[model samples]
Target: MLFNSAESQTVNIYLDDSSTPAYSVAGCGRQNDNRGTVVLTSGKTGTVLVGVCSGENACALMSQAIDISPPSDNSCVGVVASSTAGGDTNSAYVILTWKATS
Candidate 1:
């Protein structure tokens, strides 16, 4: 994540229809140590929700449904998730990359 503002941002990741986040991080924009691994069955689709906040207000939010279809010969694939916050003037960005092990 790219942090431009003085205050750090919080990021939360939710899978499916769960009300609680599957993963969460505080002060995420300040460092590069934020990372996690999730396993999903191949040949299936799932919804992912990502939310970013600074204090009591929300800075960014995104939700997308992804299909996990690995090659017949490959056991893993790379996936990248990206989003931006704080609008045009003072925007911050979050990027997440991981290897999908199906």
Candidate 2:
């Protein structure tokens, strides 16, 4: 899921080795929460790339490696990424969560 706080920006999400975004969310002006799911084999790992764009130009970029593992029973695991120092104004953040499905 992506939670974009920047009032006039857009957040783009990309999966490993992909040149195109897998998901995109407009800033608070349009939407606040955008969610998606990616399923990977157990013990598999990949990269997540994020682009914060102001119009057609990128204002900030972030990347991280992600490892998939089942969460505890009845619980979800989450990872968060924030742009800028202390997540100042015009910054965007993403929360990636993992949970086991029946």
* Top-scoring candidate (TM-score): 1
Runs with alpha carbons beyond 4 Å of true place in candidate 1: 1-4, 28-45, 61-92, 96-102
Model 2 per-residue lDDT tens digits across residues 1-102 = 555555456666677777877776665432546645554322334566666765555665454545545524343334444444334444455655445466
Shift in Å, residue 100, candidate 1: 8.7
List model 1 lDDT by residue over 1-102, tens digit each: 445444555666677777788777665434334444444322234556667776667764443334447534333222233334445222344454345455
TM-score of each: 0.48, 0.47
Scored by lDDT, the top model is 2
How far does residue 52 in candidate 2 sit from its true spot (Å)? 0.9
Query: Which segments of candidate 2 are over 4 A away from where they belong?
Result: 1-6, 30-45, 61-88, 99-102
After TM-score superposition, the amount by which residue 50's alpha carbon in candidate 1 deviates from its true location, in angstroms, is: 0.4
